[model samples]
Target: MKSKGFTLIELVVVIVILGILAATAVPKFINLQRDARIASLDGFVGALKAANSIVMSKATIVGIKSAKVETNIPNTDLYVLDGHMSIKPEHIKAAMNIEGFMVTNYALTMTRTTFVYLADKELTMPELRALNCFIHLTRSYTQQDGSNVIDTGDLKVNEFYDGC
Candidate 1:
């Protein structure tokens, strides 16, 4: 008699192989989310830098305030472009809604400077532990020594903290 269809054993074997392949592939797909997060962060950093430079040169302090999502992109606000720069507002929204970003001020000058320190909202406890992931940007610059410089202002990405 000729076999009419795949045997039970053969079908079982095929199912096992498919299961193994799926098991291996699922984790990789899950990890992709983390990669996306890193990419978004990188983009945000670049945008912030661009915005800072533009505000420092061509715009005023009010220009920096327009760096929010609502001012630029409505609703989702994943990206905010203004002052000759585009920033990912979604990062800030994520940080705000998810508590993933924490803004800290590095007082280089006894008073507040034009730049604000931005970083991952969720940092390790003790504050000092998370001090490394800081990004600095100056929206305002003063002319000193016949040049425009942040001088007492700077931005940190915290990723470069402790030689990271």
Candidate 2:
């Protein structure tokens, strides 16, 4: 009588095929987290722009145009520099959800304000920036003759996610 069981070679071939399929798929799965982080950063940039728009509209309505004037959006503890939406944590948090995010550094003056991110709160700003996974937002006043302030609302945004 002929045996019905499969030969060892057939089983080994099946296992080899499965191994090849796994090898092809593993890398994609491994990069999902990175992709997600990068996408989130994109969304974050959009939110920042929206917040700035809101602040600008409020500033116009409130007539907060003086270069030395503090940005005052009523009913929020948030503040900006020179009537522009600053990169302050409080100012940003007012517009979007930043549950797990942490700010590494923030500085503000009458002429400019900057906000830098620490991808991880435990990591130093330099470490996070070296990984190319940080955001740097700056709002500054523009000068016409390198002396006279012409515009008080220019925002510069720099975001990186190569090492997300």
Candidate 3:
């Protein structure tokens, strides 16, 4: 006799194989979030570096790179931080000028140099730890204020993506 349908044992075996495949696939899918977060932060870092270069070039050309504004960055109130060789953490919005970006988490710590950001807003503090999944940007002290930016190795961008 020819079987018109799959036997119960065959169906069970197929289901078990599928279950194993699904189990493996689930982990890969879950890891996609981590990868996405990393990529996003990487992009952010690139954008930040590009903005720094632009500010640096403008500073070099126009002779304005301090924490104060000698002249606006063509059209914005961005006072280039030549001291840190980057814009102030507070001026990131003005520097990047991306639409709908709210870097509200940025604030000067007590030392007024280091700033840590969650990078991914969807992440919660309790999910891991605040410091674990943070992207840190540190600005070193410089002598110039309202002056042009020079390459002094003052900008430090570090990421601790342990919990991401």
Candidate 4:
């Protein structure tokens, strides 16, 4: 009699094909998490740049040369650009916009002439954490032509791809 269903050989072949497809697809899905984290970090850097520019423009308009400014937050001080209020870690946390991220640390050194924002704890992946992935925003003030000027050195991202 003619067979009514797939032969054992055919079934085995189909199963093997499926397994191959899964092997390839699984890796793609796994990489998505790493890509997502990288994208988030890039977005944060962009936001920081925009915020800094806005603050600087405002400060220039107001002729303020200091990096200290009064912010909307009561009892808290923030950096200033040109006279405009600049953003700080506290503001970012209060916004609660970024998921799985925190402002890990903030410090001023060199007699309060340098400011640093550290966001490291956001990287939750074991590999990334082991790599010590972090983001840094540093600003230094300098005396130029008898006026204090703010110099944003760079936004740094420390991420090792192997960890991701």
Clash count list over all predictions:
14, 0, 6, 3
Model 2's TM-score against the true structure: 0.72
lDDT of 2: 0.65
- The candidate with the higher lDDT, 3 or 4, is 3
**Model 2 regions more than 4 Å off:** 1-7, 65-68, 80-83, 106-122, 140-152
Highest lDDT: give the candidate number. 2
lDDT, residue 68, candidate 3: 43
> Could you give candidate 2's per-residue lDDT for residues 34-92 as a string of tens digits?
77776777777787777767777766776664435456566765555565666666667
For model 1, residues 1-71, the per-residue Cα lDDT tens digits are 99889999999999999999999999898677555555655666675565456443433344443442224
Task: Please give the CA lDDT of all the candidate structures.
Answer: 0.44, 0.65, 0.60, 0.51
Reference-based TM-score of each model = 0.44, 0.72, 0.70, 0.59
* Better TM-score candidate (3, 4): 3
* Candidate 3 TM-score over all chains jointly: 0.70
RMSD of 1: 9.6
Off by over 4 Å in 4: 1-3, 68-78, 81-88, 94-96, 106-131, 140-162
- Report residue 106 deviation for candidate 1 (angstroms): 12
Candidate 3 lDDT, 1-164, residue by residue in tens: 98799999999999999999999999999899888877776777788788878767776676665544224655565656543344455577667754423244334342234334443343344543554655666655444565634344466777878877
